[model samples]
Target: MFPNEWLWRNKLIALLVLVIVIELVLFLVPWERF
Candidate 1:
């Protein structure tokens, strides 16, 4: 695989993981305290 392609793929995977984490946090935390 090309280096640039590998880098982009890694970035996409990282972004997805971050989104999932944020979603989980929002779902588990109470909204009234904010």
Candidate 2:
């Protein structure tokens, strides 16, 4: 595969992981303390 395509795919995966992490943190943490 081309380097550009690989880079794009890596970026997308990284973004998805980041979003999942944020969602998990929000879901696990208590909201009433804020």
Candidate 2 lDDT by residue in tens digits, 4-28:
9899999999999999999999999
The number of the candidate with the highest TM-score is 2
The whole-model lDDT of each prediction reads: 0.97, 0.96
Error of 1 at 27 (Å): 0.1
Error of 1 at 17 (Å): 0.1
Could you tell me the TM-score of candidate 2?
0.88
Score candidate 1 by TM-score against the native.
Answer: 0.84
lDDT of 2: 0.96
- Cα TM-score per model: 0.84, 0.88
Model 1 over residues 1-34: C-alpha lDDT tens digits?
5799899999999999999999999999999999
